[model samples]
Target: MLIEPLLEIRDVSKTFPQPRTLLEVLARQPKRTLHALRGVSLMLRPGETLGIVGESGCGKSTLGRCLAGLHTPEGGEILWRRQPLSDIRRADRSRRIQMVFQDPYSSLNPRMTIAQMLDEVLFVHAPSMSSAERRDRTDSLLQMVGLSPGLKNRLPHAFSGGQRQRISIARALALEPEVLVADEPVSALDVSVQAQIINLLESLREKLGISIIFIAHDLNVVRHISHRVAVMYLGQIVETAATETLFGNPQHPYTQALLSAIPVPDPDIRSLQVGVQGELPDPLSPPPGCGFSTRCPFVMDKCEKPIPEFFDSGGEHHVRCIRAHSSTFSVPA
Candidate 1:
């Protein structure tokens, strides 16, 4: 039997207007906008983690927002198990897609206590839950996320970044969502705290079988958590493969550059490596062809034209690069 993927996005697109000057904007025709995401297609299986890794301004966050319905795509389809998500009933939708944002300290309201926050979710998603049941579940959630019921009365200011993030996870899990969309969830925390949260998420996935779309700028952080990884660059996925395949034998130049940047922990090896070159290309009216062509070391003349279509890199592995499908370029030693 074919394993039916839980989430599917097809040709999703989002663009934002770029106005250089007030006079220019008013006098001339409407100018080009930042194409935050362009014709992006992807699939997520149930109870699996698909890591989205990219540098800043590469549209990783925008795609996360689109997947969680925080920002509707201007084009394309978002489907959950073959059914269009846009057509999902509101009540079901609430219990289906949940988001855990970065900066938990800011995501919470200063006025609401932990109990109140969890209660609100219960009220919206499970109103049938009695006050006693809601209170009971609140405690359960706190414990589940490694927080304490004793701290339930405290405000956001009382907890450290890690603790606050735990609360955020508790709240996201409150409705027992089928899919958790996390956007830079650990980027704002200390390294130790980041590890704890990552561990917690992995444990929860095992225990609850909830699917996760984990988005982060650091591929190293996602290395342990993701089953499959998709590398994004300037509004498109340059390569996608299993975690082992991606890290060990990357196909796309962008993916290779990203891997090369991962700092070697050993001091002796640190001095030997190089990094990706050039500043990120302007997203507004992105270049005619492969966006990374401007910086790619092995870019061919074909790269200056329209990007080659996604090419197969064997079973379940895909890469979008002329070099990827061409017989000419060999993997660097």
Candidate 2:
């Protein structure tokens, strides 16, 4: 039996126009556009966590924002259970999808107390509920995220980074959203705090049976929590597969480099050194073909031409490199 995807992104593209300088304006130069997402496509199955991993500025956050309806895409369509996302009413969409930002402190309102924050969401989504009902719901939300309901009266400023993030999670769950777009939710917290939040999210997913799009550059964290993983490069997803498959046998050169960079604690075992070469391509004017072509050690002449399509290596393992289409293609030692 085939289980349909709960959320589907098809050929999505987004661009941000740079502000024109006075000199450029006077010279009649066209405004530069940053290609944030380029024909990116993926699927999120019901009750599964999908990890999106990439270097900084690889459009991971942009994709998360798009999923949560924070930013409108310039091209392509996102479907929520086969229905176009744009066609869904704002109120209905808010109840189904929620976002947890990277910085807990910045995402919360300092003036609003923990109770007030959660109450606001409930008030908006469940206006029919009485004040008593809303308060009860608020208390439950706090407790659900492993927070004390007694701290509800305190403002966001009074809480630590991890506590603030718990509040954020509570607020996001106020409406009982079916999908959560967690955009580097633990990145700003301390190392110890990061693990706590990660465990919290993992537990919440199990308890609520909610789908999650976990976006982050922390490969280790993603590997621990994600059922599947997608590797992004220069605003495009270069590879995607089951978590173990991707980490064990990465097909793309970029993916291989990222995995090789992971720190191996064992001094006895020497890890491969496939570090990526050169800097990321400028977003304002990305390369014509494969985004990693400029830095790929095994780049062929064809990699500089027409962009490659995803080649399925096996069930659920897809790679965007032209070389992956050939059975014998392997990264040189």
Candidate 3:
């Protein structure tokens, strides 16, 4: 049986103008822009968690923002349930998609009590609900995220870091969104707290059956929660496959380098670790051809000619590297 995607993104691209200082502007300097996302496309199935992992400055957060309607893509189509995202009513869009930001402290308002915060969401989405009904729903939202209803009267500052994150999650759930785009939700918390939050998310997903787009730099966390993984590089998806296939049989050189860099627990293997060399190219003036060519150990003359389109190796495991087709190709350890 074929399953239709809950959401689809096709040929999406976004760019931001680079800011110039007053002196440069006065001198009539040519304006430049950062290529944040380029021809990106992906499918998200209902009730499935898709994990997007990449290095810093790779535009992971920008992609998330585009999906959540925070940034409009200059090109390409975003469809929700086969309907154009732009055509969807604003109120319906809010109820169907929600975002959980990285910093819980910064995302919440300090002046508003927890109850008031949730109440505002209900006020906008469920305006007809009576005060008593709204209060009941707010309490339910608090308890849904493992927070106590009693804490609704307190301000955000009174809670611990983990508790504050739980509140953020609760606010997102208040709208009853079908899709949740969580951009580094646990990255700012302590390591122990991160585990707690990750577990909470997993539990919530099972209970609510909501689809999630989890964006983060931590491979282990992505591996634990994501059914499939998409590795991004320089604003483009380089590889995507089932989590086990990606970890056990990585094909692209970039993916291989990332897997090799995961820290091994054995002290004997610690000294033998290897990582990718060279820094990422500047986005404002990216090099021609493949973005990973400069750092790819298996670089070829063909790689410098043009960027390769994604090709399925087998079983829908797709890769963009031209060298990925060669059975003998391998990244040096």
Candidate 4:
């Protein structure tokens, strides 16, 4: 039997209008809009971890926010278990999906103790619970993320970065969410702490059977944790495939370049470097056709005219480049 997606994003698009100057407004200058996400789509299966990797401004966080219901999309549909996400009640949605933000220090309340923070989540979501029950639940959440209940009374400023992140995870779990949108959860921590957080997230996924959308710029981390990976560029997904397939046999030029950038630990084995031509284009005025057309090494006349549709390279592998169908296509030296 085939299983349906737990969450689905169909042709989602989001744009932010640039703040206009008083002079520009008086002069009747056209308002410029930054296209953060353009016709992006993806699916997350139940109990699956989908990794979204891209450059700094490539809409990774924007996509995560959209999934967590933090930002409403300007276009397209986000479906939850075959139902529209907008139709879901806010309280129900919060209980089902939660977000672990990038900066643990900033995400938490500075004044509130850990217990107070967790208690707030439970108070809002599980108002039926008694005060004693809520206290017990908060302690359980702290213990669940590998923190001691004794630390619950401490302020956010007292903990280390990794410890604070674990606290953030605990707070997110207070609602018993089935899906976790982890937006660069480990990016700001120390290298050793990063591994610890990654293991914590992996362990939580296994123990709680929760699906995760892991977004980050770290390719190695994504490969280590993700079953499937999606490569985004300038508000569009250029390629997506299983972790090994995308790393082993990248089809899109942009994906190949990204994989090529991963450093080889051993100096004896030199890796082939694939360089992209130019900088990322301005989102307010993107290139006419494919977003990567200007920077792609294998660009052709046709790639500059019409936007390429996703082509199935094989099982579960999809590419959005026009050259995806070509048998002889390979990254240039």
Question: Model 1 over residues 1-333: C-alpha lDDT tens digits?
Answer: 657999998888888877668787678866768899988989999999999999899998899888777788898899989999889986787688899999998899989999999999898789798999999999999999999899999888999999999999999999999999999999999998899999999999999999999999878888989999999999998888999888777878788777778865765434333357888988987878898988987877889988678988787899989887778756544
Candidate 4, backbone clash total: 0
> Model 2, which residues run further than 4 Å from truth?
265-272
lDDT per prediction?
0.88, 0.91, 0.88, 0.91
Candidate 3 per-residue lDDT, tens place, 1-333, comes to: 757999998888899999998988999998889998988888898888999998998889999988888899999999999999979987888788899999999999999999999999898889999889999999998888888898899999999999999999999998889999999999999999999999898889889989999999999999999988999999899999988888777777788788768966765444333457898999998768888888876778999868888879887689998876667655454
> Local error of candidate 4 at 47, Å?
0.7
lDDT of 2: 0.91
Residue pairs with backbone atoms closer than 3 Å in model 3 (clashes): none
| Cα misplacement distance, residue 251 of candidate 2 (Å) | 0.7
**Comparing 3 and 4 on lDDT, the stronger one:** 4
Work out candidate 4's RMSD over C-alphas.
Answer: 1.8
Candidate 4, pairs of clashing residues: none
Candidates by TM-score, descending order: 2, 4, 3, 1
Which 10 consecutive residues of model 2 have the lowest summed lDDT? 264-273
Candidate 1 stretches with Cα past 4 Å from truth are 26-29, 264-275
